[model samples]
Target chain A: MIEEKDRTLKEKSLEKAPTGINGLDDITYGGLPKGRTTLVYGSAGSGKTLMAMEFLVKGAQKYGEPGVFMAFEETAEDLAENFASLGFDLDGMESRDRLLVDHVHIDKSEIEETGEYDLEGLFIRLGLAIDSIGAKRVALDTLEVLFSGFQNEAILRSELRRLFRWLKDRGVTAIVTGERGEASLTRYGLEEYVADCVILLDNRMEEQISTRRLRIIKYRGSKHGTNEYPFLIEEDGISVLPITSLSLEHEVSTERISTGISRLDTMLGGQGYYRGTTVLVSGTAGTGKTSFAAQFCKAACERGERCLYFAFEESPDQITRNMKSIGIKLQPYLDSGLMQIHASRPMAYGLEMHLMGMRKILDTFNPDVIVIDPITNLISAGTEIDVKLMLTRLIDYLKLKNITAICTSLVQRESTEGINAQEISSLMDTWINLRFFESNNERNRGISVVKARGMAHSNQIREYMLTNHGIEIRDVYLGPSGGLLMGSSRDIQEAKETAEIAAQSKNAARRKRELESKLKSLDAQITALNSEFEVQKEELDKLSSEEALRSNALAKDRSEMARIRRADLH
Target chain B: MEDAAQNNNGPELVESDTTPDPEFYILRLYVAGQTKKSLTAFANLKEICEEHLGGRYRIEVVDLLENPQLARGDQILAVPTLVRRLPPPIKKIIGDLSNTERVLVGLDLLPVGEANVQK
Candidate 1:
């Protein structure tokens, strides 16, 4: 029994009592300080009471430690009925001798005091309740009501101090809840000052959208996360997201996975993305970005791997119908439950809620692959910093879990392709940029690999077409002006080039029927123009290499990291 | 018993201490044990009833220490608490009952005036 209170992993001086709430234990390192009263304060509807109740209920059910819940404001029946929605069988737990709920209702109008008295009635009731269940944990929700219940503040304050002391002496891990005040943590500003550990929950509205956040104010002798983590109150109770979860701890995978499109796969290191790496595809609207995300999901399902697809702009039905037009039949995978498409609007939640919601889905689905179609719409949910912050931790988590992630981003145009992806591009292992190329008054779709971190990928722009079957990658060909030619302009360029090649090398073209060779030989006959083109290509390569350079301004940043991971093998 | 309570010689006396009282007081004194505070509260209440309500009041001492679960019935929290059971609207008074004026107001024996309304 004593060992239960000593579950601290780091030091023996400070013990912990694990509150069975999900994600809360992860942030508090283990749980609240054991055998000591921890104060949780929040405004009305901030979930302070629910958190405290869950703490006691979880202690009773999971840790085999019976608990006494002393609710100052609500009845035992009301508490039981309220928790039933969260799937906690409070009445059953009480019946099984694992829990005891004592409702202490104090209406100043219903009582008469004829003499000087201490809170001995409260003490006796709490003692009997605790002893009845042999409770190892206790929860006093909204204990600040003592200020309102009793008229004499002097004696009530003294008794409160004594009550906390008595609770500690009893050696039961306890949680005390307080109502949030304007200046102090509690309305009376006493519990926060007295408690060993203090946690603050805030549910505030920004732009008419509310988000619940929890923060640890102080943990007397222990280290805790200080960041304001967002939490959601769902059917399963409060789930706090410890966003400070990942920091360069992801293990790298060398195994390759296919990108679904054969030619597109070839463009990306002749295989596809790294097994557990984040792949980002940035393009303008109607540039086949969603199609790429869908293809990624289909490929995962084909390989008998579970995939989860998050569609932001389209509904699940809409996406299924849209993908059907491109000949990507997702209904079979949907029916087989191999591929799960979850669709929601960007305005539905704050950035943290969306991220936490995805984290929850990721845990339950445990998918091998995840696709977020057009993450650019997430900008509606938060600022650029928020989107970047969410993507950083999300990608790191996915990599740590060894799940392949394909995230699509929609930029404004071809000129702003990598620019829109600038905030997220650095985090991706592979960046696939699609373009809506317009030439000769018509637009065509083209794809290119901007960066593939650990693998060598083709830099050539490959024109692709949406056919009756799906996306078809066309032959790689540059126009006479050394630019990407799309639509009928590409066909016109190709036919004109073919005629020029036949006229220049009738015998040489016959000797080598391949197009690449014919073009190469034709360049041989072009005199000084070929020499000038060679010099230009050389300079372009240097400019491109500088961005990927340790030879440039980014080298100093690399040297610092290189110093950290300097163990015999770089 | 003290000069502080004797100071509030208001209309409660004109109705009860001076005239033949008809309102019977059924008071329940909730105490945890025979502690000094509980005993002091009980003694003070007996003297207050003798002086104020005379033979019209009846005091019942319920020790919560002997029956701990009985504390929940009247939502008793403070030790040595007084419950006015016979009154149409029940009221509670907590503490050592040292402040007799406040106890009178709490038990509806004295006019609480704006203080009761404000609370």
Candidate 2:
């Protein structure tokens, strides 16, 4: 029993080969099963050939493993030209003795079979190519052409089995691409023969928008992601956007960064956003969502940190021209190599492609912060679920890398009830809402912090104005009516208070003049009464002197009668 | 008779000495393991050669089970296949040669009118 368990564990530990595509290796844990045949089936234009070629090119270029590509559909020269746009120099790799491209042409009309035959010619050719290049990897593009070439199904089936067994015995990993069938994974049901691993590629159209998706149907002995991943085909070639690690094991940061506007910073707990957290700035049209994001980007650039700004709705030139009106000079930052503005229409590619492009830029630019202006425009490119899944992966990847990201979403004007925020609010660490508040026959911009995780934020809605000097948040005007007033309403309220103060001052001046006149009249009355009293006193004194003189004369006559009395009086 | 012919020497002969005609029929039969189909195809081919060309025909039988490496020369894909190498245009017919009319038609031995009637 113990031995059986050990054997099972060993079987589970089957080796894998790296596909060398950007996110595919992570999904398959490594890549297709190593030294085994892996069937990659998809419809036309679904990037099957490109994926196979990239696997070979990357194998030779990055992994130091030589590869042989036997194309049954396109010639080597045609393939070289086809891949030239992606900068894959097949001829160069060929000359280096690390790659071999052999085109196997099988026209049924030209081939005449007589006696017993297997696909020995093919086996010999493949064997020579592999031996010539010492290839560790082999890719047979469009392996279904054999079905058209050979009429005997039994012979074809047995030969294919032999071919796969030969490839395995040679100890070379092989990838065989097949056309998608109506009911089976491959046109000829080749998956049944080469079933070590199977990957299905699909291109679907939804609402006139096309999206390419990839799913791993089976992996023989290893644990792999079973989700359908969105893949993109661009100038760099096909890239699969695998979901990042789902575990929340990423490190968190307590450090803060400025949001460029001082008032806005104060509203977010007196500091800016967290170093590696996601911030959602949601607002309706004309609510300065782009301007707010630009402010954050400018702040990051000014601090000598790189910032990547993805503009979906507007061209880079348009963004630059519009931002200049708000006093943000992105040109300097761009010229200094601290900021990069990548602008493209949301309809230009699928959501996963956009994510892949962003990831490529992030790796090459190594930005400290990333800004997606009006992320809601991406909703038009995919379903709500697709966009949400992409954003989740993006946010998770950014967090894992310790890179701060600011995403602005344009909410519909009619749904001012926070429905848009409700969609992505749970995914963000901070949410700031902007709205157009109309008051006193004028429209004014208002900004409020909806939520800031792990920090305290102001709950008051501040009226902000987007002027030539940038965004400025105004203090709430508490009027007599008890609600915050803004725009022309605040101006009218201020004018009314000024008029009332002026009238009260005028009444005080008139009262001062009347009191001065009354004091003057009282002083004059007192002076008149004093003068009357002085005149009466002078008359009384004269009367008293006269009486004294008469008394003296009487005393002299009496002194004659009595000489002794007179002498006593003298 | 087919088993005895399997050991016949010299499979690369241009023609049999008994018939020096330039228009002689050159035939080769491929088989594996002397199966029932191989015996029937060989017997049918011999009867057709006897009745059609007589001394002007040559037959070479190759057993692929004994020599698998020779399977690549004629692009052989199935057992019990007959190849007509001589006539300017080469032809191939698969399966056991049980239907004499198809064999004759496939090998281009029947008269033009009879082949048309068979078709």
Candidate 3:
């Protein structure tokens, strides 16, 4: 039994204890060692209490590891009530006795720390608390509160050291949270040094934007994240994102999907483009830029794929109605939540706020395709530098997340105004130019795929038409008359007249050939009739002569030899 | 305990807000050599001081090449360490100050905080 006890103690000395918090372990590289205390220092409203509770809750709930929480700041009832609001069943865990929330009331008025008095009483209480539940994890929340009444730093520091060492000796992984000091990482600098690991949480407010930053100041035996990481505190709990730096090695699907309009997809390679690629359609006003964007979104929605359309120029309702005229029905998809149309003027908010709103919406919806119709409008509200920076961040974010982002830019033909032309072109994976070219005395909107990275696309400027039916691409309209070059009313009129004349000549030639064949057949029939007539006349003459001979014979026989004539007539 | 903390307060030196030390400066120039580059750097710095820091600044030029031992006193490693010791926090800029905008921004003369866009 003695040998077994020593073996167990040796095992306990080497085992590492996990902090059991969702993302905290990842940040700490692994976790704090078992039986070692970690100091969690942060200012008020910095999620100190939440982190402590999460550590304990994860231990008790997930690992089936019992825990002890001694709160010097809040009563057990108060802690339990706070947990109830967060939907954490603290009472249920307490009933199972796998968890214990102990309230240590250390009133400044009654406390006295003398030199001879060792922290044996406090140690005894902690031991009893851990022993009762066989707890492996312990939390002493806000140890700084004990120093509120004490003026001597040396005494407080020694007491903290004793507390941490006692907890370690008891073989329990302890978390001791404290308030941040003005200059030091923690209230009592000694606590940070004595603890096995130290984590600093900062709830900072800059430009009215509240952000929480977590940094691990020190970890004795383990490697940890030393940089400040941004974390989000929501109703559920804290979520830490390390700002995923994406690698270009992630696999992408090369299969093409139709863009609803067969002509549009045909212009973009045979079928369409690979998924998760940004497509930029830039043009001047009234070049069917929005129509082209709407076509892709409509196609995605039709395929039961989710699409998010951000219309900066038009409202969602107006876009829906306008699309209806072009036979692009989006209402059904909107009703099904598969299509989300978000519309707002560019001047409605700042550039960063707009980007943040887009980010929030993206996180919530996670659609397959995202469309930012006319990004120039959104960027025009900011300075060139701000626009470039925001676009860089947004594009980088999209590429990292592998989201297919399409942006339409309205390039004014009269004025060369855009959001940093260099960056706009550089950031886009593909750029499609839509221009109105004069053809046959009429203005024709020409759609051409200028560049598609890693894919082949038709380079010809196909004539595009937007009618009541939908968008259409006419055949490569090329002719020797150069009707496309000389686009005027007279040119169109001449072309139309020329087409009419050509059709008339084709029909006249067909009619003349038919008449010539019929006349030849009629002449052959007339010759055949003449030949038959000649033969019939000969036969008729033969028959008539015979009858004449018979009559003459009969007459001769009657006049001379009646008997011979009668025999000849017979 | 407060007395003990006081005992370990290192050196007891009362610094004034008005009087400037020989090494301290409202304006300062730090150089390492008399090379053409360093001479041009000193000339440019002197011109800036005469223009912007004429009345308010008392320029103190520290040549590290002449007194290398003084480098340790100011914890200097690079050639030029312009310490604004007259002002609190003693802002230091180590360069020839050829890029005016960078010097201004790095010296806190220009507002380049995260919340503020310099451009």
TM-score of each model, paired residue for residue: 0.75, 0.69, 0.53
DockQ of each: 0.44, 0.11, 0.01
Q: Stretches of candidate 3 above 4 Å error?
A: A1-27, A60-64, A74-98, A103-125, A149-154, A190-192, A205-208, A234-236, A243-256, A273-294, A305-322, A325-327, A336-455, A458-570, B1-119
True lDDT of residue A266, candidate 1: 91
User: Per-residue lDDT tens digits of candidate 3, residues A144-191?
Assistant: 776774545675567677677777788788788988887777766645
Task: For model 3, state the Cα shift of residue A380 in Å.
Answer: 12
| DockQ of structure 2 | 0.11
User: Cα RMSD to native, each candidate?
Assistant: 25.2, 9.4, 22.1
Q: What is the TM-score of chain B alone in each candidate?
A: 0.74, 0.77, 0.65
Q: How does candidate 2 score on lDDT? A: 0.82
- Per-residue CA lDDT of model 2 for A186-256, tens digit only, reads 88999988878999999998887788899999998788899998776755777677647355889999999
TM-score of 3: 0.53
Residue A407 lDDT in candidate 1: 89
Model 1 lDDT tens row, A155-239: 8888888989999999888888888887766888866346588899998876656767899998888888888887767656887
Model 1 clash count equals: 18
